[model samples]
Target: MANKIISQRISPHLWFEHQAEEAAKFYTSIFPNSSIGRISHYTEAGHEIHGMPAGSVLTVEFTLDGQTFIALNGGPLFKFNEAISFLVNCQTQEEIDYYWDKLRAGGDPKADQCGWLKDKFGLSWQVAPVQIAEMLVDKDQERLSRVMNAVFRMKKLDLKAIEAAYGEPVGAK
Candidate 1:
């Protein structure tokens, strides 16, 4: 007999210090088509090692914009950094602004650069225009250089500015 695999194909797991539920709720609220899933609570049997009271939330399964994620209340032994980030591909400047403003609330100001931001929980996010990817991979080197320069000088990506750089020269200003 073969064991049945009962799990998401690949879900990003987030570790937090007793705030997994709160963060999950906040994330689900911000992204459309998102919601909190089954929440698992700690049991008294593992209190000695886990150090958490019985009945407390241990893990929360949630969906953000259709992506599966499991938030674990695993204490503060670990912290989120820029090593891994969620890249949100925005189709318009409006979408960029919306996500940037919402996710940047209580975020680190220093991390707000190159379309990247660290949220209050220290999770990094990249709010970028979808067109930028298409432009960067374009065969035109002149356009690539212009887009690169424009992106370097930006915090939240502006679709119009990037598209403008696609045809203009480097120093055209």
Candidate 2:
């Protein structure tokens, strides 16, 4: 068991204020290839030091799009911030919209801009279409500026608009 635990590669560990399981379930439900893994609860032996009820959920191991994560129900000494975020690369506008909507449910409207949103759990996620990076890397400075300007003005990214800004030529709004 120790060898198996040590063999796994580096993965993100999230801290939640007693919502490890709830957050895990919410995340697994949103992403197609995600699921909750092992759930370990605190034992009576640690109650005096941890201050948590014995048998309460202590940790939850979960997967999001096959990437492993560990969520700990540590007390609210820390928080999820914009400094760290999950970037979801999408191929189509539909994919972009799907993730944006689901992740943004009960999200912080003030924190949303340039494809970034903070979920109810206060975790930031960048939901961007893959094409945006390709567009930004174009040698054409004018086209790059267009896409950047369009992206900078929006909360959730609009792939079609960015494409239009990349010289697709569309009717004026």
Which candidate has the highest lDDT of all? 2
lDDT of 2 at 169: 36
Q: Assess candidate 1 and give its TM-score to the true structure.
A: 0.90
Per-residue lDDT for 1-173 in model 1, tens only? 01322276888989998999999988988999887888889999878788988999998888888788989999878999899999999878899999999999998989988899999889999999877767777777887898899999998888788888887533344
lDDT of each: 0.86, 0.87
- What is the C-alpha lDDT profile of model 2 across 87-135, one tens digit per residue? 9999888998999999999989999999999999999999998877767
Cα lDDT of candidate 2 equals: 0.87
- The C-alpha TM-scores of every prediction are 0.90, 0.89
| Model 2 ranges with Cα > 4 A deviation | 1-7, 168-173
Residue 144 error, candidate 2, Å: 1.4
